[model samples]
Target: MDLPRAFTIRESSHRVCNPFTTEKLALLGRAISPSPGTRMLDLACGKGEMLCTWARDHGVSGTGVDISTVFLSAARARAAELGVADRIGFVHGGAAGYVADDPVGIAACVGATWIGSGMPGTVELLRRSLAPGGMMLVGEPYWRREPPDQATVEACHAERKDDFLPLPELLRRFGELGCDVVEMVLADQDSWDRYVAAQWLNIRRWLDANPDDELAAEMRAELAASPVKYATYEREYLGWGVFVLMNH
Candidate 1:
């Protein structure tokens, strides 16, 4: 019904929750250049930034589903702020296995691909809601470089080295899924900093206001440890991007 308190606290200030800045997001939207009136389905659509912005810039209509009521509220407000409220809908529910009533011009499972277990399953789930010839957008992380050790892998927030593929192999994965790699907008180190570094501020602010909260200690420890961890491992080893794919 709602996201974990930790997640909500960490991302409370984020409009787009992945390692993408506003420029990269705009670049991705323009690259795809969804035709006016195109329909989109975005699963686990954090704060509905993609759909709302597309509705404003490209005139696309869409539905965004997420389990977090907090994010859904932010999404609705964003739609209104962007004056695209009529063009998009926000649903507070689990995104896993959810499909649109009709095939859409774009179907996406960004960042939260765990909804379908992994990349392949998430791609299949998106395909179920995509119209013929429509594109699918997947936001995923890849290994920027092979980690030198298990400690590095763990520092990068991966359980194992295989948790993410190198960039070339990741593209090959789309091919394996029977999709063409049509377009992609990748996150640079600065973008990753924007995504990860901003969380510290949000968590710090939350801690200041709610010192007695049960999660405060955890947030403080994360705030203390995250910067070193990110700069050391994730910034160098992990890369994230939103890839556009088409059925082959």
Candidate 2:
């Protein structure tokens, strides 16, 4: 099993594969300050950036699971590049029902919470692999401002007004799930740009190389419309963060 071709193509150049920039990611890592030798389990760990980096910076060890072979390959290369190959392992598999064999110091599902259906289920899934008092990291998006209309909501890539909560409500949801909001690092507009804008270039380069590809026209349309759509709707309306939670 693998990720859709469109996803891999759009984010082919991305290391983190989310709205988080390297700085924001590092900030989150430091905020948690995982002790050396801590064990982590990262689900839907795109390109394994967090795992590889933490293994390098904090001397932690982890396993990352993802459905994309392409991303898994990139993840392994990243582990080798950071000289942390021995500290991390990657598996090519679905993350929806996957749990670590051992209770971990940290369990994370970043950006891809749909793997467990939604926030509550995702938290439960992470908890299955979390040791007592260990941290659970969830990366998610919130509405920065309420969308004015259905068109705006659609533009922001939400099916309805409730697709994402505003920041305060998001935190409250964590409380509702019986977790304390321990720490967080948010994505700024610039970081959002780095994540979204870069996709256009990747799509453009791919279109140039594969003009006859079946998805080329679709990608071209997306490339043409994405910048304006992003600047108008997503950049201003969406806020993303990696939040650290501990069970209460």
Candidate 3:
């Protein structure tokens, strides 16, 4: 499927729907410390926000790959604004089975594991880019409490047992993938609210400007219904985190 325009517009909007905000970014930085100039790869790097920020702050060079044309344009603009275009690159491509010309010190599939099929597949996907002892970062969601019913999961567009795991099982899955539990930053309800709810205002603004765009109407419909659905369903039942891992 093509990248959704709603996602692209939301990416450029000042909303912080993506998990990589200043707090999360700081946590990710501390977890994946590529040596100076270490090459990094961000799989499904929407809008290149994390890579651009990482390169600028950590002095590492890297590339961000995503299938979203709209987000790629924003990523390019971000790199230019940060003056890191020379040190970093953005590829308009899919993350599934994607690799770099050279080995990278860090490989990440943050919040977009579906690109590699699922969590297990995505771990294998990122490992291909890792040099010996290199790190991989995965962002995922777990169930904070057992959801009372299947409808809650459906509201999040997930099947009853898909895309949501208990935190312990998440760590266990990483261990099964042959990675040590190196570091992790869990997102609380507040952060999850920041991620999902902030989207409403942006979509509202976009809907106001593009009153006639077909996608805007769809977005407006989703936005109007999302807040209550999100709070009662996903937020109450789910847990999320970005975990950094290294081969054992």
Predictions in order: lDDT: 0.94, 0.94, 0.81
Pairs that collide, model 3: none
Q: Cα lDDT for residue 211, model 3? A: 91
Model 2 misplacement above 4 A: none
Off by over 4 Å in 1: none
Query: For model 3, where is the 10-residue window of minimal lDDT?
Result: 11-20
Q: Count the backbone clashes (under 3 Å) in each candidate.
A: 0, 0, 0
In terms of lDDT, which candidate is stronger, 2 or 3? 2
After superposition on all CA atoms, how large is the RMSD of candidate 2?
A: 0.8
Q: Model 3: runs farther than 4 Å from truth?
A: 14-17
At residue 122, candidate 3 shows an lDDT of 89
lDDT of 2 by residue, 88-170 (tens): 99999999999999999999999989999888899999999999999999998899998899988888777898989999999
